[model samples]
Structure formats: C-alpha cells, structure tokens
Target chain A: MLDVTKAKIIHDFAHDRPLLACRYDPKERFVVTSSEDYRLQKFSLPGGEKTILPEAHNSWVHALGLSPDGQILYSGGCDGKLVFWNIADAEVKPLRTLDAHQGWLRTLSVSPDGSLVATGGNDKTVKVWNTQTGELVKQWQGHAKNVYSVQFMPDGKRILSGDLGGAVQLRSLDADDIKGNFEAKPLHTYEGGQMVDFGGVRCLAVRPSSDQFAAGGLHKATNPLGAVHEPLALRFAFEGNQLLKSHVSEGITGGGLWRVQWLSDGTLMGVSGGSSGGFLIFWNDQQDKDFSKFKLPALARDMDLSTNGLNVVTAHHDGHVRITRLSES
Target chain B: MKCPYACGSTEHLMARRKFLSLSASGAVGVAGGLGLLTRGAAAEQVQQKQQRIVVFNMHGGLSQLESWDPKPGTRTGGPFRAIPTSVPGLHISELLPYTAQQMHHLCLFRGVNTSEDDHGKGAYMMMTGRRQTPAADYPEIGAVAAKTLMPEDSSLPGHIRVVPHGGGGRGSDAAYLGPKYSSIHLGNGNPPQYTKRPDGITDEAERRRQEFRRKSDRRFLDGRRTAMTDVFTYSFEQADRLMEQRDVFDVTKEPTQDQEKYGTHDFGRHCLLARRLIERGISFVQVSHSNYDTHNENFDFHLEQVGEFDRPFATFVADLAERGLLDQTLIVVLSEFGRTPNINLYLGRDHWSKAWSVLAGGAKLARGAVLGATNAEGTEVVDIQVDHAQLFHTYLQAVGVDTSASFQIDGRELPIADPSAEPIWTAIA
Candidate 1:
C-alpha cells in the first residue's frame, strides 16, 4: 500500500503576507521560502532556526528558482527585477539583477545544467539569460498575456514556459547562436486553461528525469445546470508534447492553488483550499483511482517535494515550516 | 510531373500565373529557386494549385433549429420567422437578414449527427474528422491541409488560426500535429496584440538586421552543406521568409473601404484577415467567433449573435466572389454541435449532438442550396442523414480532396475520411 502522511509543524513563524512559494536545495540541507511580505527566509533542514533575508526584495517575492548545481538562487518579486544570489558566499548580496522586464516577474526557471536561466514576466515575454554572463540570449515575445511559470527540460536542450492564457509553450535554445538573439519558437502548447477550466496556468514543474510535468491552478466555469464549477487541478504532460491526465482537487473560495512542485521520484505536490480550509496534498501516481488524495494538517501556502525524495516540506500561511515523510506499505 | 486532373481550368491556369508572379517578385536570392524547386516535390500531389480554405469556427454549440434548420410555425420553433433568401425558396432565420440576402452564395448541411456532447471531444471530432483517442491524438484538418496542400515556398504561414484554441477555456485545440503545426494565436479578440514590431527598430535597421541574419545563416549553412541535408532545410528557409513578411498579419495597411466593409468587430476584422491570408496563398485559415454557448435566454442570445454574424459573413462571401477567388476558396462555417430542440425553463438550450448544422460555401460546394433536412420538431434528421463523418467526407470532396484516400498509422491502413461515409454528391459541384 502507498500513502502520504504529513507530520506536525516543528516551528511556527508567521508573516503578514502569505508565503507564496518555497524551494529546497539539491542536498536538502536548507529550505527557502518567498513571501508576499516582501521577504525571503532561509531555514535549516528538519525545522531548525530560520534566518530572514529582510533586505532581499522590495515587493512580494512571487517566484523563486534554484540552479541545478545548487550554487545560485534566483528570485523575482512584484518589482520586476530578477536577482541572482551566489549561494556559496556567506555574504548574501545579489550577484546580478536583470531589470529589462517591463512588468512584475512571475517565474524563474534555471536550466538543468545550470547554464541558462529563463525568466517570464507580466510584460507578456519570456527572456532567457546566460547564467554566467547575465546576457539576454533569447527572448520569446508572442504570448498575449502574462507568463506564469517556466521549466527547462532535464537535458537542457529545450524549455517549457506557461502563460496566463493557459498555454504551455516549449521553446528551443539555439546551440549555434548562443548570443545571436535566438528566437523562442513554441514546440508544444498545452491548453492548461481548458484542463482546469481555470483562468490560466498558475504554476508548472517538470519532472527530474522524464519529459513528464505537472501544472496546477484554480479553475472557474459557468455550469448550465445553474451551478458554478470551480476546482484546483494537476494536469500531467508526458514528453512535453501533450496533457495526459488531470487530477482535480477542491477549489479555493477566495485564494487559489498558488504553487505546484514535483519530486525527483515523480510524486506531485501542491496546495489547495476548500470549505474545510487550505491543505497540502501529495499526489502518488501509483495510487488507485479510488484512493488518490492525502491532505496535510495545516493551511499550506505553498509546498515542495525534496529532490532527495526522502522528505516533503510545506510553507504555511501561518509562517511555519512543516516537514513530513511518506509512509509506504 | 503534372497533376493528371489538371484540365487547365480557369482556377488552375490562373494559379500558375500567380505562382510565377510571386516567385519572380522575390527573386533576390538563388536560394529562393532551390526552395521552390524542392517545394515542387513536396506539393506534387496538389499539383501547381493555389486553393484556400477559410474555416469560421462558431465556438460553443450553435443550434441548427435556430439558425439553419428552422421549423417555422411548429412548437419546437421558437419565436422567430424564416425569411426568404436571395436564392428563391431558400430561407434562413429572420435574425440573419444579411446572410439571407447572400444565400445564393452559401450551402447548408442540416442533418449532421455525432455522439460527443462534450465541447472538447466534439471539437476534436470536428477538427480532425476522427473520434478522440486515448493514446494518440490526430492532427486537425487545418494542420493536414497545411501539410498536404500549402506550398512549401510560400513566405506566409501555411496554416493561420487567429483565435486561441477552442476560443478561451472551451477546450478547443490542435490535438496531435505537435507544436510545429500549432497556430500563431493572435491573442484575445479584444484588441489584436503581438502584431507590432518592437519600438526603436527603424525600417532600414530592421532590413539591415534581416540581411545580417541571412548572411550569417548562409555562411553557417555553407560550412555544413553536407551535414544538415533534408526536408528540414527547406522548411527553415520558408520559415525565414515567413519571418520577413511577418507584417502580413497587420490589417492597418489595408484600404479604408475594405477594412470598413469587414467591420470593426473582432470576428469581422479577423474574417477580413483570413481572406487576406488566403489571398496570400495560405492553405488554411481559421477565424474563431466566440460566445455561442446560449445556456440561457436562447432566442435573445442567438438573435444578438446572428445579428453580429450576418453582415460580416455576407460581406465576406461577396468579397470573395468579387475577387474571383470564391471558386477556389472553400469557406467552412462549423461549430461543435447544435443546441437542444426543447428549450429549457430558463429559456435556454442545452447541449445536443444528435443533429446539427454546418455550412459550406465557395470551392466546389453547390451554390444557392440547402442539403439534408430535420424532422418537423427539428429534433432529428428525417431526410438525407448527414452524420459528422459524411459531412467531413463531403467537405473534403467539395475541396477536390479524395475522401476515399488512406494513410498508414502505427502499422494500420486508415482511410483519411470515415470509411462508412459517402461524399454527398448533391452538395458538391
């Protein structure tokens, strides 16, 4: 039997604004949380003391991305600049800041090889920057709406970017013209909007080794039966080509499904809200259709599956980190 | 090799002249000739053809009873009257006076039946002319037309779909053709976005940049002339030229009279653009019109929609005929399915896939006629049954495509059109 069980929160720390997103380092030694309170916190593993980076950003840090090598951290806020942090250095100062985006940056995705970082913003553009040189190498300029999330393929050959229009556009980075203003032509586009019946893609995450990925967000629909249809959905895409399946969760009344992440082991994780209140759910693909959902205890603002696959963590709206393990039979 | 069916008709003969003119107008590079020569082989099946297909996808389910199959003076017939069209005895909804006036130029299929009521699945069935698959999705008709009919040498896109898939959260999409054949969506219909060049890039500067890129691409290709050799090379060259003429999407440069005739509505303007694209030798263009889902106030809603649709559709058909392009341009008006014959208490129509309607005009469709008919209540097809498969077969046949043709997929020999379907000869020229 396969099951997921969330443990009790070890430490509780509250923030004025909700914790919008969270991430873990490759080694699982540290956890990072970005909040709408305009602050980022770096916490030691297994619920130790946390160090808040109060001077990190000016506005709400809506997005956070870690380089594949775990050497650098990229964060974007409502202020529209992508700040890169050198993870190895004791002094946490932004190594570089990209201010070319016209609107608030919504997502940041680092290539698996740690060579490229793709940033999508509310300006309806996705721009790729060379991690080492900070040069804008490619720009995807076609989406008519704000972009929400971006994920690079495991092999670093291609990348996927999602927009507010519910499109998952796969863009290829030209190898020959590394700095020659490579145009991002979409290789695949998913109607993430249709799958969830939602407004658009709120978040997306690619699996570690496979082309399979997950997209999660809120959905809204007008039912002919006089009932409105609303739900949170995890749409799975295989080979970055098409959406294979969709798992619907309870809908949020006011807030929506804000974050979605996949572990190296291919388990999906995300936050959802309902009448019973907000909860974190771990999706085990191996679960039978009848028994698929496992809700966490607290109101998780965001959640992440560890790269090591041994632990799962949740960033609570109450400002606490809940670390838990999966109990498999 | 010449197409065996080529009788040097006005269409085929005129197409040849236009093709020659287009090739000559862009004769700056020797590469252009090579692209055209290679394009010759890929398009051998289509001959030296320049046919266009404009698909007006009426998103949401349009009711056959309310629009095309009116049961006038019957209980099922809502509060609406049938108006006589320009073609004697042919009548359509009073709501569509404009379309009625131009009815001589249109053809209606009123007996279409399907099993899928879900918007997503129905859309897939309509676009691909096949049932939805659990494993492998199929390419849409536009994608297939782009593959089979579009000239590989054309500088414009072979298939252009201006609306986002399925018209905003309706689950409409290009299923299996992969992203390569996906549409360059013109974003929302609110105000066409993504149609402008970046600021600070002067025309001279832009041309210089393109020239530089071309030089760089040429030098790069010359260095690996032996390594990278295949149909991809030809595709890339065509894509390069398409990038140059990207401004073809702009409607601002069109004549004031023409733009005004197309109207200021998004759908109307998009229809004009679709015609413009087809004129430029594009094989397929889909213009999506939205908000046809009339779950409430059915009669009132359809009245408004048909009102908006009437003038533009008539104007488009007239414009096509005026340009002498109607004979070679197939205009298809399609939707997912029809609404319920019985109006609900909310004065609404629910989803019904049993019987509906689709309109075909231009190309070889018999003009000034309505094919097939529904029962008295407009609830089911009682005369000349035209299922979705047969409708698709008739459409392909009217466009000069062989409906009986077959293709191999996963080791199985599959007919392109449904095997059980027979093309409706009455609807085809």
Candidate 2:
C-alpha cells in the first residue's frame, strides 16, 4: 500500500531556524511545527501560507500532538510547560497552559479517543493529563534517566515510555506502573573515555491491526562526544514483550534514528541524522537490513505522516519543513 | 627500586625514569636552599607567603550558557534552565544543583573575552595569562606559584598536577624560570616509584647505606662540587623526603563519609587526592576534569559532565572554608574558552571567546561577588570586559603576590604579570 521509493519533495515551508518536529492536521488543511526558535509555526496546505503561532512556551518546544478531530493541538516545550491551541481558529492562541513536568518536556502521545495526553521528559517521569480540563491525571516514575520517547497503545488501555538508558516499560491505564519490560540494551552506550552516557530511545511506533511495536535509537557509539554513532531499531512482539528483530543501516554513519513509523502494509520507515546527514530508510518485517532508502537535503529531527498515507512531513535542521509525497498521484 | 608495596605496573617504571632524571631535580626540589637566588624577589620570604593555589582545569570549551552565565528563555540560551544559588540574586545552570549551595564562597567574572578560539592557544592564554607569541614564552600559573610560595623547609614538591590519565612525570612549563619549578604530574594522584624501601631492606640498613653514600659523595665532591653533582644530591634528598610522606597519597586514609561525600568515581578520587596534597602544604595543585568539547549533543554531555563535577567541587570548597585554609588559598575554575550561544545543526555549541565566565574564590577575593555582565543574549559583554592578562594579575594578587613586582632571572628582571593590565579591583576584598 506504501511506495517510499517513489517519494519526492512536494513543498518546503522555510522557518529560517532549526525545527524539531511537524504534524499534519488530520483534516489536511494545515500543518504545525515546533522548533529550537522557541515558537510554533503553521503552514496552510496547498496555499503554503506561513503563520507564526502565539508564543506559548518560554523555551524550545519539541513535542506536538493533535486531537482525533484535528481541532485541538497540544504542544510541549523544554520549559516544562504543555499548552493547547484551537487549530480551527483564524488567530490561534494558547487556550490553556499547564506546568506538565519539572524540566524539558520532551515527548507526548495523545490517546486514540483524543481524551488523554501522555507526556515524558528530562525529569524522568511519565504523566497523563485530561485534554478537556488540562488536569494531570496520572504520574509514573521509575526511570533512572531522562525519558525521551512516549506513546499510547492503540487499544487505549496501556502506554509505553522509553528512557535515555534504552529501557522501555509498558504501563496500564487501570493500575500501578510498569506492566512489562522490553529488552533494548543494544541502544545504550556508556562512554567511559569522556564519562558521558550516550544514546537514548528517540521514537516509538506500533503496527496497525497487529501485536508488534518498534523503538528507534542509537547503537555502538564510536566517538560520542563528536556524536559518532549508528542508527538502530528494535521490533517487539506484544505477547511476551520479546524482541523480534533488530533493524540496522547498511553503512550510514549517523547519530541515530530520530523518528519511526509503521506503514499500512506493516513496512517500517525511519529517519536518520548525524555526520552523514539525513536519510529515509525502508525495512520489511522479517529482515534486519533496509530494503530501500532515500536521501534528504539535510538532517531531519522528526517525521510525521499525512493521514492519506500518500504524504509525509519532516522537520529539517536546514530551517524547513518539507512535505514529501510518498506515492505518485 | 620500587615502592615497597608496588603494583608492578609499567606506569611506575616510566614514572621512576622521569622523576629520577637530573632535569626533574628542579621539579621536585622547591626546598633546594641553593636555588633561592633564582626565585622571585617580590616573594622571596616564603614564610610570610605560605599561600597556596588550586586550579580546576575544565579542559575543552565549556559552554557558558550551560554553566556560569545562563541566559535561559532566550533564543541562544539552549535547553537547561538557570536556578538560584546560595548567594542572593545569583543564579547558575540547573545542571549544578550541588554547586549551587556552595556559591557563597565563589565569585564570577562574567565578561571574559580572551579572543582565542583554538584549543592549544586558548589553553596557553588561560593558564599562562599571555598570548602565544613567537618571540617569548612563559610559565604556567602552577610553576609561578610554586617558585613564589614554596617555603624553604617544605618537604613535598611545590607544584603538583593530579591528572586522571597517563603516568606520573614532570611537566616542562617552567619556561625561563628553569626546570626546577615545573609541575609534577601525579597520574591518578599517586606519587612516583621508589617511595618505600623494598621488603628485605630494614630502616637501619637503609639509613646506614644512605650515610655511606653521603660520605662517599662528600669525599668525591671535595674538589668537584659542581652544578651537576649539586642537582643530583638535591634530587636524592627530596626523593627521600617524599617517600616519608607517601601516606598522603592514599585517599582511602580519609574518613568513609568524606570519601563518600566526593563520589568514588575517578574524578572524585582525584579531587580528594588534590585536597590531601593541599592540606599537606603543597603550594600549587591542579586538578584536570576534561573532554568538554561537545560538538554534538551539548546538553546531554553537560548533563553528565557538569553533574559529575558538581558535588566533589563544591565539597572541596566547603571543606577548605571550614578548615580555615580558605583564608590563605586562591582557588579558581576555568577552561580554554566558552561555547557559542548560537545552537548548531546538531544542537551543539561551537568555540566562542566573545563573552564567557570564570569562577574564583578564597584568599582576598570578595565572597559572593559577580564581576562584569553579559548582554541579555550573552553574545557580547555589556560591562567590565577583562582579558587573560587581567585575570592573571587577579590570581597572584589575591594570594598576596605584588603584581607590580618583578622576578630576577639571570641578571634580567622580568615583571611578574603583564604590566599593561591590572586585576579587577572590585572583585578583591
């Protein structure tokens, strides 16, 4: 159902500063992005009209999510604040802002029903909040390091959070923390030479209509201080929480895989950034190596797919949000 | 000869060769009474200037935005937040929670513009307080302090560098002041080999052998007491004294709580050893905590590095203050330069010398003081800009050395510091 080999850049919305992530409105009318410039950017679809959203967070905002109806956009920032905006408004502003975490709120995942939002960050905690009232509903702790990636299971009954040390834990919505653990040790590297702990779980994705999920990160850090590392991904079976396969690059010198997603046909797509620049890699379920790959003009920090399964948006370090058409019209 | 309880590592072998060489006599023998004429006249009376100096050399370019002068909430501020310190109105990066409580004993010079970006040249400027010119070379601060403050009766080497890597050896940074004042590199804070008699050699036998050697040397030198023989004798006598004080190198001798206060990691152990050496009256101790050149993932690396550096460094400062040593010691924390405020593509900060900060305390420095100021974005100094020359003068003057005085060397009088620059008077009590 997906043909990544035929992908081509459809448009580029320049922001003039490094961007971290982008998300398309399910309605396909506009797209919003978060960047290191400490603000959010909106670009109207087809017309490519660029608009600067009202400054909601005091620091670089990196995480974004949208309601199922695409009316409410939730953004999280390094300032530890989470804010909501009415995406349908002509002049959108922060409808409500909540102090979500202690510091550097890094990742957020919205429930399939669009009622709850889960967040994780440098504070080493996972939090869930009510989207309507902006009230914190639950707080999960046990991570020894920064929490970098978070996601809600499609069933809406559980959530998964990953940390800088590459530990992935699955938690349930009804009871206490930590339902199960998945092995992802290949992504952790404690560099003794510089006394730096390198690598982290960067992104997570679950296959539609299946019982498997994947986490992307870095492995075999050669020179961590210089960011010399290789990209890696692990797919796990939901039955025993056992690892199924470890996806790796051919020979790309990189920092790590920043974001990953499962296609309609269960094909895995990953975006890599680092010394060799950025690349889009496509992989099959049964193999550890990529089946095909595409090169990007610059390193990408985050990636999001359009609802139609034909288009994808990537946040680039070269100060542009590029929309790539993954299939020929 | 080996340390009586030696581990027999090849490092000890290299150390023995370096420390026992004739050139190293000047490095180990600050108490060589015959060498006093080559010292700085301004500080000739070491008894009156029993002052000490300690430097925490943060190697590589430490990002000012993530440490001393945080510009949080600004475009160039990066991710980490700035938290309040012990001193009222003083704030530093949140990465240094342990160090925040010890800020009362510290002062910051925020508007430093050394203008050198290369690592080697910037390090030379910071440690030696002068630009690297082709015509002239200068000694590091450790060498200067050793020659100026080491008492004639002191038994230990005056200048010591506790490095976490490499083997024990002597540095060659004394420049025109001669090799005798060079800093001794104590790898992992351990002294060189031969610090103890072998298992079979009794003390009485050792004393008798030493006496016999002295007698033989006296007879041979009756007509040939030359510079070479004098240097050799000085080296031998000092080596014996160091062996007697080898117990100071064993950090495990400290209280369990004290060792635990500083983490048991390599940097912590090295810092503890530096403390012992200073408490034992060493004139200058340099502790290196390195590899801060974060060209990628600067925030993550700082979180690890600055977090590791926070507790032990603060504990050391607090201990010095409680022991009354703060009144006589000049302590400083510095690096080659500061990182750029502009975040790069990889979220890394590049080498930036336009505006940075340095931390200093102890001796005559005003406690809880902040000197100079950076603009809101930290791109430039808005007030009280000072360079390395001024910083060098501040260091020596804080320890009671007269900045206007000169050191007499081979019939030539060299000014102790750059004559064109002066210390930030406001920072001095």
Candidate 3:
C-alpha cells in the first residue's frame, strides 16, 4: 500500500492572493501558477526562481492548460479572455489572445496532439479553439448551467464536458468541418440525488489507456447552507458511458472534490475541502475498501501531477503551492 | 366631546373605539378625503392618492457583490464581472444582465448597514423595518401598505403574498395593525387555498352556506363586541370577496407569449401573478424567490437563482411601464441582508449584514440614481449608510405614504416609520 501520509512537501511558493490554477510543464522543470492577484507566475522547479506575467489577464485567472509539447500555455480568466503564452528558458512571452467567452471561463483542456483546446465557461458554453491560431473553431451549447469542467478523450476524437447541474455530455469532433463545429450528444449524467441544483461535477480525469474516466464532486447535499457533504468519484466506462463504480471517501466530509487526477499506475486521487479544512484522498479501482485520505492546511483550488509521476502540486486558497511526493509502498 | 358616529353610551364607546381602531389601522381615509384631526393637511393629500407596492424579496441574503453593488476585479469579487447598465457609469454584476438593461427605472442603494444577521431575525427586521422586539410585534411593510393605501371599496385583498407555504420568512402578518391588514397568502404560482368552491359544492350552495354562517355568527355575537370576534367576521367577509374575484389570481389567463416571457419557473410564475394581482388593484404584493442562502457553491447557486430572477423581473418591470402602472407602482428588490464579500472555504458566501444593498424604483423615484456607496471590498458602508428602517421609510415615501403619520394601537401612538430614520432624499424624485 502506498501511504500518502508519509508524503513530504518539498517546496512552497507563496503569493499575495489565492492561487486558483496551476500546471506542470512536460519537462517537469517548470510550474505555472495563476493567482487572484491577476498574475501568472512561472517558477523553476527546485530552484524556486520565478518569472511573472503581470498582465496575464484583466481579471482573476481560473483555468490554465499546457500544450502537449509544454512549450505553450493557455489561460482563461474572469475577464472572459483567453490568452496564449510561450514559456521558453524559464521566461514567459505573450503569444495571442482570444476574446472567446462572454463570461468567466472556468476550465480548459487541450487535445493530446495539441491541435485544439476545449473551454468550459460560466456562459453555459463549451467552445473549441484552434491551439495554434486563437480562433474559435466550434461553439456547442447544451448545458443548462455553468460548464465547470471539460476534457478531451485520449483518442482526441471526442470531448467530455460536465456542468453545474451534474450533467455530462460527450461531443464528437467532426472530421469534415475544418472549423471544428460539431453536435454535442448527452452521453451520461449522474445526479446521485445530491441536490443537482446546487453541486456539480467539478473535475474529470481520463485514464491513460482511454478506456474509462473518473469524475469527482459533491454528493449528499445538505442544508443550513454549506453544511458538510460527501465528496464522491464516479468512474465510467468510455465506450458505453456506463457507470462502472463509485468511490466515496468515508468519514471525510465537507465540500466537494475540486480536482481529480489518474496516476500512471491507475490510482485515482482527489482533493477537496470546506469549513473544516482540505483533504487529499486516494482510491484504486481494484480495492473495495475505503479511500486513504490526508488532511491539508487549506482548501485546494487546483492540482497538477508532475510529468515524472512522482510528485503532486496543489494550489491552495491560503496562497501556498504545496508539492507532495508520491511513491509506492 | 360626544363621538359624532355614536351616542355617549357604553356600546357607543365600544363603537367609537372601533372607529378609532379603523383610523389607527390607516385604512379609514385611504380612498376618501376624511381628514382626521391628527393628520396634517399635506399628509391627508398624500394618503388620498392611490398607489401600490410590489416587494420582490430575495429570501436568502443575496450577495451585493453579485447584484446591485458589484466590485468586480477586487480580491473578494468572486468569479463574476461588472457590466454597465442603462445608466452610464453605473455597473451591476454581469449575472444580472436583464436587470442591468432596466437600470433606468431603478435606484440602487449600495450602502445598507442593517445590523441583524440571523435568518429569522434579519428577515423580521427587513420586513418590519424594526429589530425583533419582545415588547411588541410590528407590522411588515406590506401590511402597512395594505392598511394605509388599499382602497376600502376594492374587492381584491389589499396585501397579497405569492410564496411557497412556510416560505417568505416568518410570514407577513399584520402584527399590531390587526388581522384585517394581514397578507392573503397565496401558494407559489397558485391561488389562495379554498378560494374556489369545493369539488362537490356548487357555487349556489356555497353562497347559501356562507349566508347561513353569517346569520349564525351575527346571533352568536348578539350585543357583544370583541376584537377577536370582529376579526373572525372580517375574515369571512374577505373570503367572500376573494372568492368572487378568484380569477385575478389565475395566471393561466395570461397569454402564452406573456407567460413565455416570464420564463415559466416558480419564481417567474409568481412574478407574473404579482403583476396580474397588482393590475387588479391589490395594494401590496410580495413575491419571494428562494434558495439564495448559498453558503456552498455561492457562484453556481447565484447564477441559477439570479438568472431565474433577472429576465422575469425585468419583464415584469417593463410590462408595468407599458401598462402605465409604473407611475403608480413602487417596485422593491430586497433581501434580509447580503452574503459576505469574503468567499468561505467552501467557495461560498455566508450571511453578512454589516454592509449590503436594496433596489427601489418607479412611482416617481429618481431614475438612474445610485444612492450611497460601499467601500471597494464591499465590507462597510463608507457613505450615506441606510438601515432597514430608513429603507422601509423610503419605500413608504416613494409610494406617497406620509412617514410622519402615526398608527394608534392600544392607545399608544407610533410613527409609521422609525423616528430616527429618514428617507433617502436622493432616491426620491
């Protein structure tokens, strides 16, 4: 068994405000953090040297996506603008800007080939853009609420988008349309009877093999406004959109999981927190038992896995970026 | 001096007391020119005019940051941005896009410092314009409007509440203003209960039954006078009147195009019903939108609730203007308080009353006026802090009520508004 409790925080980068989104470069030598201070900072791993993009976005940046090659960075902000940046030799350069969304852009996902980027936004839209050209390729509108998370399937032929109403849609990319315009079909939805009106699917992770995906968010909604609720992860089979299994972290209750990631070894991890504090939970599909969990210092807003698959970095609401080592027992 | 309406006998004294109670209720001279000696000539003139008030109560403390007083780009501003409205240089939250377009008919009060915080207490304070007190129960603004502005000859209930059962805070009772002024509670988007005859009961049979009951009640009250019995008698009469005009509460009578414009949700339908009831001469209508107490996922819930509220409210306001009722109707958008500017660990906002906002307009209120101001973080009132009582006073004043007038209850006279409070003069035309 791998014990996360023994994981040590190797480095902590502090900012003036909460860091909302973060990404690890493919080389695993650089990390980019987006903050509420409206700046994006690129920090050299291990060295702690930082390069700041002061005017990265007009408002708070909530989402960031790194190209498959890791040379390009894309950020979406509350200003409804998406900007592309080129990171080379520990320096940041502004490349292009797309006034794509009408409202706050929530999440961004880049294709494996780095040809396209899909964005989910508060405007209830899932938009696809050409990664190289800053042009909006396709706009799909089926979600009745804010689309919180979007991910491109490993095959790159389909995109999965989840919304605040606990609805998920699988949209197939049209090969014939050069503009990337495609129809979105309802693939799967899971309300879990947890007040679909309030909570949503916050995070989605696709397996490396592209056979299945896991979604993490709140279930078992409560009253008194913000009272503790269970954080859940539902794993679905990619082909049939069948719900294969659900893993709920027992005894760890409060807010919904904000981020979910599938480790190279097929282990699933989720980070969540509420009034009490933050928590890191781990689950393996083969195990029928409870998840292994660890407490954190603050609410985790975003997380990224190192390219080496040995360390996990989390951006916290307390303005600390925590890097934790992961190893097998 | 002997009472002109009654002789100097014990029964006559009781009858005179009833007249005093009627005058104290503020309903006696609402439509007539019967000027009481206690009322100033100007106050009498104000009371003689017919006006209406419709309070759109966002039940949970709506975040000021997401509505009327947006501080976009601030650290505490959350994920939403500010959008410019019809009034140049004035911006509200982007979530209220529809309301933004109708800002010319609204006056925004961004610096309300109501000190109460708990749901029940805060709701009481906002509804009554006074803090919760064990000493006495004060009437809500709707009840006061019903008592002071409702025409005596009008068949419709003066104060109508469109809310889900057990919603709308502690229920808008008349309190000391007496039962006659209490709100006629209607189900959310549905008519008041029992307004229609029972399934098996014919209308003729129902009328005959009511007539028989009135005769029996008269005999039961033979030569005896009590406020409790009078309330019962008044309730029966009001029920009869409501039954006669039940169609006023039927929103289905509205055209499908109009209903579609309202968006078809419960809150939307309730707003549509409110407009219909107001058109039928109801003096005060309160429509409540629920589930704004978003301590968890504040942004998501606000997007849903505010989105649900925006279009219908804008459509309602615009519809009133097109019907020429805007000049006579005062529209109020309020809540018990506001949510905290500081997003909590759950990414939600908690109850915050230290600084908040309320929106009022129409009935000749200054259009495109943004009164008062909050600090950049929206944490405190930096200028022209208006409290609950002051807001209540403004609502009454906007609808042509005399704030200086007093309501006499139990021989104790009380000013209609808190004496220490004053209306926001900048908001008044």
Best by the DockQ measure:
2
Q: Once superposed on the true structure, which residue ranges of model 1 sit more than 4 Å away at CA?
A: A1-329, B1-49, B164-180, B188-196, B201-243, B406-415
Off by over 4 Å in 3: A1-5, A89-91, A175-196, B1-45, B164-172
Which DockQ value does candidate 3 get? 0.42
Question: lDDT per residue, candidate 1, A253-280, as tens digits?
Answer: 4224556666454667666543234555
Winner of 1 and 3 under TM-score: 3
Predicted structure with the largest lDDT when compared to the true one: 2
For all candidates, state DockQ relative to the true structure. Answer: 0.01, 0.59, 0.42
| Segments of candidate 2 deviating more than 4 angstroms | A132-137, A174-177, A238-244, B1-30, B34-37, B45-49, B86-89, B134-136, B189-236
List, residue by residue over B257-326, the lDDT tens digit for candidate 2.
Answer: 8999888987898788888888888899999997788988888788778888999999899999999989
State each model's TM-score restricted to chain B.
0.79, 0.89, 0.89
Report clash pairs, candidate 3: none
Q: Model 3 over residues B1-429: C-alpha lDDT tens digits? A: 222212344433554465446634756422221112112222353556689999998887889998988887787888778889999999998888888998998888888998888999999888888888888788898878877777756666678888744322124387766666778778666777776777898878887997798678767766663555555666676677767778888999989998899988777788899899888888999987876888876876787678889999999988988898898999999999899989876668999999899998899689889888999999999988889998888888998887877765544566788778887777889
Model 2 chain B worst lDDT window (10 residues): B1-10
Q: For each of the candidates, what fraction of the native contacts does it recover?
A: 0.00, 0.56, 0.47
| Candidate 1 Cα deviation (angstroms), residue A215 | 44
Q: After superposition, how far is residue A77 of candidate 1 from its true place, in Å?
A: 58
